[model samples]
Target: MRASDPAIRSALDHVILIKAHLLQLRESLTALEDVRHSPRGVVLIRRCMLDVRMVFEELMLLSVSAHGEAGDRVEQSLRKKHRADLKIRGLNELNPNFFPDAIDLVASDEPGVAGRFTSVCEPYLTVEQAKRIYFRSDQLLHASRIFMSTEDFEAHRGELIEFYGLTERLLRTFEIDISGTGFMVLGHLNLDDDAMPQVFEAQTS
Candidate 1:
């Protein structure tokens, strides 16, 4: 029998709906380019682009912000619900720090970390900037803390990755003339060389 939770179905529906809009926008833009010679066509195309951008920016924000919206009972139920969050099961109970150390290489059945990592990044990126986002491991874990339930974490994980991928694709589609998009990546850095290799950096570069 198929698992049929209304909440799960709703979440899936939302993601699918969001992706469908993106597909429509892509199609519309492709269609728009063909009609570029007409002033009315250009205006309409510009409007569509604006609308798509606005809609997706809101979506990306929603995807990230919704992570911990499930409430404290859900968040603090780790011991009682061992399999509730896949991260908890995968996490080393004997050695609690195991998950933090392996976060960089860990891949769940769903895109848990990947999605969280992706959503936190800005859409427009230069070559160097893109590298920073790819390496933003620490921030991803910090953000994933809210996904207490394995079901919830796995369920919405792909959306985060999609959000990040959307940014890259949007930049490509528009040739993103980002002369001054005023976007920057912020991360922590370790300052103490004598602190030990085990310590994380203490600065954002």
Candidate 2:
């Protein structure tokens, strides 16, 4: 896809939204500490779960946006499927290449010249990760019986922390390769104050 392609633009827009979601996730995670002893602690946990779930959903939508029309079809199909596992499986089938295996953080010492940098291509937050978190969130969000006790809820705190860690690593500075054209690098220069999506493009090898 060309730099000016609408799909690229849309994907970048999603990136912006994802950044906002991440910010919310951070707030929810921090609040967990303050409420750990309070009865409302469960609320914070639910918020965290919701935030993680949103990130997963937005990531899927962003992937779909990268594919243009084909992605649109997958999105339509996803709308009818309420199962998170199926949605992820369908997206994987649509095109696994749509998801980046690793993100390259290119550093440039001079203007307009790409330089050496680090690559984070670890297999974190893959489809399986999404499925696990998504379904867990669903289970916690829609309680079929009495809500989890504080002890039970506390047990899952470790998992929530892990989710945040993996998500941060995945989005800290990542590259999404656009087939046939190039790839887009989406991240934040300063995640605290500069929460905006900083996007850069480069040709694929």
Candidate 3:
């Protein structure tokens, strides 16, 4: 895509960088299939850390679209924290994936934990909703944990299993190994098996 606005162009550059970082993350993770306990994935993720920030910079400048209020939080986190933290606390606030907020649950459970999460997330979930919310680095990291979950969630969940078993050691590996590999797999993938398209549409878009 081409643009006449310098800021918008800059934003696209950041988006391109984000895409590259994600690709690298995938490559590193996939590399661990044969190499046992490889730190390669973590290393790649570290490199992409900066790229993640760039994406947010561009997104906010462009303001080209919206993923609801949650997106605003992601943008703020990028401004306040380093790229590395984005994976830890920025990911969740920016990208909730399937985790819906208040607007999503207004019709379902009104007095449950899910409802609570949604409620806090709502009024601010959509760009049209609250207009803004406090975005923090921790939220990004917390969000990434879920955002980068493995392909087969049902088989090995909450086991703290990273990439095959790396989830348990995410701090050291930057994990969520799906390629049956180690951190060398780089921690990026598109498929959210059995997930609704809307779950990841914001990120993919």
Candidate 4:
């Protein structure tokens, strides 16, 4: 929280902005108990899903800014493990430092290495899942013919919410326990269905 770099401050601000949008999306979802999707709600949710998926990429960019080579190593690991063309294209759009060769960034035990960062990320989102979400979000962004049924919308809503919370915890607290079950710590941090919707309303109003 006390970092001197302007980039760190920017990263924090971006995270807060992303969180706000995600919260607002949830607020929209709350009004749809009987039906799964409204036209407005669908648009908002898709936008938020795109943003939620970008949360990690943004963080990785920040990590690259802070740690340079170490961060590059992690990004490269993610890229190599991630085979999808859509995701590769997305990665290409990010900072060049986030691309490079030759390091096991995910499993390395060395202190201050990118592996620590990747380790924190692997459980919540593997490269494969990231690619899937990235492509789906892109499709939704383009107003492509992709359609989400009521059930699909609900499932995506839940998954995006969890992803947002876990990414938040990793970015804000620098905590990661791959050994532990799911993001329980994140669930405790105001991400619950009951907890966040109320707080989000209060903050927005």
Candidate 5:
């Protein structure tokens, strides 16, 4: 699809919002280190899980928004259901091509290079990975432990960190193949500077 197409623009807007939530998730994960044994640690951990949930929710919404009228029916059905697994499955059935198979990071050969660039593709986030993370996050979010102990927090620390890493890779640079003829790439030019999200376009077979 063309960059100016309403569907593409709407998808870009979703990317921007998802990026903001990802930044917040990163902050929460980083803050967990100093207070992992305290009450504040539990709060941060929960916040991280919440952020993940929100990210997946937005992703589903983005998919629905891109499909027009058919998408509206799916959205309504989604409203009636509250299960993450089912929601993911529903979205997949609606459009299996909604999620990209891998992320593409493009770099210039030299400082002044204009047209000379190379892209490295990494298969980090896939539908299965997303489902795993989403399910785990939901479980942790609704766990029975009201005030989790230090050992309990430690037990889940590695999993949470892994989830964060996977999520970061997914958002840092990825493309969504909307159809057979075109795809959209979304990423940041300079993450350190908090630059605005940028979207690029390319044609495919």
Candidate 6:
């Protein structure tokens, strides 16, 4: 069987569902982008952040299901009876730190290996950014904290943009054929640069 074989039906389903969810999320982000000039933009920004957090959660689920030893557990958790259990498992399994493990898996002594892997895997958002977004999204979603200054709003808005970019990249990079859009290079296939996200260095003072 080829690496592109459909033998892993559950993973395929998960990818499709995640893509669909991402389409919903893109709509939300586009709405936020349009109304960003208004004062009400803050609220929309918050909603986008929440959606980003959700997308991140689903990405983690896909990561574990696709790459972890507990892949079978991930499959079980997808069923109706196991959803609650899956929530707990997701918390532990989807930790963004899993990126390092993924890096390790792709580690090689080849000169360009590190650069290529970092470009593809860690791409835009850092692990720290992921955690911060998840945390802040939680605070905003539950109304556990309420302080929205202009600076804070700008910061969150920037983060939301970055989050949006990262999510889009992940979907495109690891996407499967069932979704009708994806960038995974089949055996002997070349990666299409236009299909990949444009890389930009984050400015830091």
State every prediction's TM-score relative to the real structure.
Answer: 0.29, 0.80, 0.29, 0.47, 0.77, 0.53
Q: Which candidate wins on lDDT?
A: 2
Candidate 4 lDDT (Cα, 0 to 1):
0.45
Best candidate (score: TM-score)? 2
**How does each model score on lDDT?**
0.31, 0.67, 0.30, 0.45, 0.65, 0.49
Q: Poorest 10 consecutive residues of model 3 by lDDT?
A: 196-205
**lDDT at 128 for candidate 1?**
30
Model 6 agreement with the true structure over 1-205: per-residue lDDT tens digits: 5543442443444545555555565676677666754557767766676566666555455444434445555445544432333444454553333331111124568876562233354665555666667667656665535457777767777777777676555444332222112212211101223232221111111
Q: Tell me the deviation in Å of residue 80 in model 1.
A: 42
Worst 10 residues of 2 by lDDT: 180-189
Candidate 5 stretches with Cα past 4 Å from truth are 1-4, 105-123, 143-146, 179-190
Q: Who is ahead in TM-score, 1 or 2?
A: 2
Runs of candidate 3 exceeding 4 Å displacement:
1-4, 38-205
Tell me the TM-score of model 4: 0.47
Ranked by TM-score from best down, the candidates are 2, 5, 6, 4, 1, 3
lDDT of each residue in 1-205, candidate 2, tens digit only: 6645776677777777777777887887788877784557777788888888777777776766755775676667667887777777777766565554445557778888676446665645665676787898867887556767768777767788887777766666666654323445444423567646765554434
lDDT of 4 at 2: 36
Q: How does model 3 score by TM-score?
A: 0.29
C-alpha RMSD of candidate 4: 12.2
| Predicted structure 5: lDDT | 0.65
For model 3, what is the error of residue 144's alpha carbon versus the real structure, in angstroms, after optimal superposition? 17
